[model samples]
Target: MSVQTFKPSVRVGNWNEDISLDEDLLKDFLEKREKGELLLQKSGRLKKCILQKVELSFSKDGFLHFGDVIMLLNPENSEESLSNPSPIYGNYTVSVNPDESALSSKTQLTAPCGISGISNVKPCARNVFIITSVDGSDYGEPLHYGQNFALRTRDGFMGHLYLTSDQKTFLKCCKKSHLQEVSLTDQPSYETCWQFVYLDPQLRMENEGVPVPANTKLLIVHSKTNRCLAVLRKYILWTFFGKECEVTAHTYLNGHKAEENENHWIIVTGNPSDDINTMFDRPKPPSEEMNENKCIVKPLQK
Candidate 1:
């Protein structure tokens, strides 16, 4: 496979405010330097300055370096810029444009050009499962997999979810092995792997020692992108009821949060009958069966 390269525009700003290095600010800073004024404030100081345009690059080290200063790119907080007091001494939002190349490369385990074996690669699991809504009235449309991965409340069947090896992209009803030439197996060659990441720290603390409810709202993160999965709802005539619903990965913290609906999605799980053994398969124990129920999918509560 060819290594993909991404060059996203990076912006820095205050965490709690919409402050960033605007053209006016940059120009003002230049004027101050020409006047021989001090750049450092008593509390907050301008640590570094950029003069001419320089080539910016990102690596697997998770830091965007320009000259002597470095910005920490925390995967846990993938959507926002973090505060690094040593280099840049304040809260800054280091925003990266969510282009395909940049997104695919960032989520990979190694550099795009590095020689990482397949095992080291984090590919989306290929599994056929149902995305059941929490209200128990609707399901994702399997037939619409090629179109938008639409979901509806009535007359919809189970849709198979698949993830690419990079884990940043998603596909429907496709096997990773089929996407790449590999061996065959009686078991599913691909699986849809997902998890609920807590959005509120206080909510997490409050629910400590208590089992999380099935209806809890979470950011469904794909293992590869470390970003949230969101459904893009638009009008479509081919859907179960002529309404189109599509799923896409989003980086809302990067100032694009308002562009996408972060409030959607509840949980994803297998069909209710997934635990029962078929004629060709052996029955799993209750404990094992319960583990399969973790795929929770539902609409966000109003």
Candidate 2:
């Protein structure tokens, strides 16, 4: 194991937008600055400006850092949608439901719909998210257990992730552990904060406050409800993302999540250079531990 240190990236653009400097806007802005039309006030590192694309934050060391731009990928499943032109399955990324196409515009405009307990709320907003520190901690901060963090969307209306009370009547068996829904809010309220629970509660004593490695199996517990973030084999005919699976949040009624792997998630973030569309097909590390060691103890019951 190597100590992977990720130096935070410099960000430009409006709030929550990790500007891809490769855009034409960067060239246009830089040319103006060089021509004396755009003046930059000198700062610690602003004596001279360079225009090149900096990578988005993805952790390299074994742990996921606070500022890493990550995707919450549920484990792969054999299920597929019956109606799609191509196969759509359950190796789904936890994403925000975006604006739908003309055929599906019934999916209302995609933006923060105020708070979570409302009757009408959808959790999935955008595909990608930035793991941010709850207290405005400096960039590249290591995310540790027992610490709170906020998940802010990257591609669209910037909002923090929150648990919703809406019943996804559209989903089958809507009363299961996946019963409760997840959505985004316009502000970072108590509902939007979350804590990471290592599937192996034994790891807690040693790894508390340590950086969590990428690809490790973990439970994302919603701070407000104490329910864990989960995605089932259940697929929804999404207006925008095709037949993507529903990303919901809830703990099991019996308190033992031992029944299924749907409640587990892996942070498959990579270096800015890694492929965004790729997925780790190996068995979920946490599930494997649970099976081999019979580990049902995240304070979880037998």
Candidate 3:
């Protein structure tokens, strides 16, 4: 990605009437600057100097920086509406919401509020990310266990990927073991814990009395009587009785369900540091170890 260059047009007038910079004002001011006759300063000390018809430059990452001039708006003025006519010549931060329309750059302006010269744009405290897993088997869709696909957000602020459909099918593929020893009459009791980590813009709980979210993925499996204590110790906290407990789960605060559970769990995150490396370090089995050699041990009867 490359950087964008913009030539800003300047205008000199009592721009306090409206917050917008019309085409006429922009053309007049820019044409003057080209001829080296544009005035940089105003006559009256109390007169407001506002920037109009300005073209903003952005970095490769879509972050806006740099400015030509700035003006301080009267914070006490109630008649001025900053939402409609954002005060020119000042720096402000913008927040991104999960809603698709919130990322639009063209109609970013909203109706004028009571405040003058202030922008309606507010800083975002946290970024919303979603992960959805699809169980292709249930829908007649084959699992692509070893293969994965990637996706991106409209604004380029977020991205993620999951196993290809065919790869999931490979997970279910099986081979017979060579062991001839006598079969154990009884299997140990099944008990394991699983963690469902995801983002919650409102940080609201999915169900009542549930500390985490609802329908969280059950990833861990344990043997009855605690025979497989090694795996149990690693993921013990995610279990309640003899089954996987639902910890923090996905609850898309924007009235959207951001989770998918097709055979495997699909994790989504907006944290700048969240990535494949971070997920790999978690409790889930490595992609390589998910081969046919793995066996599904049943829980022992109580």
Work out the TM-score per prediction. 0.26, 0.55, 0.15
Kindly list the per-residue Cα lDDT of model 3 for residues 23-102, writing each as its tens digit: 66888898866854443322111112111121211122321111201111111112333444433322211111122222
Best by TM-score: 2
lDDT of 2: 0.53
> For candidate 3, which ten residues in a row score worst on lDDT?
226-235
Clashes of each: 15, 9, 31
Best by lDDT: 2
lDDT of 3 at 127: 15
Error of 3 at 288 (Å): 7.3
Reference-based TM-score, model 3: 0.15
Candidates in descending lDDT order: 2, 1, 3
Overall local distance difference test of candidate 3: 0.21
Superposed model 1: Cα runs more than 4 Å off: 1-191, 201-210, 234-237, 254-260, 268-302
Better of 1 and 3 by TM-score: 1
Ranking by TM-score: 2, 1, 3
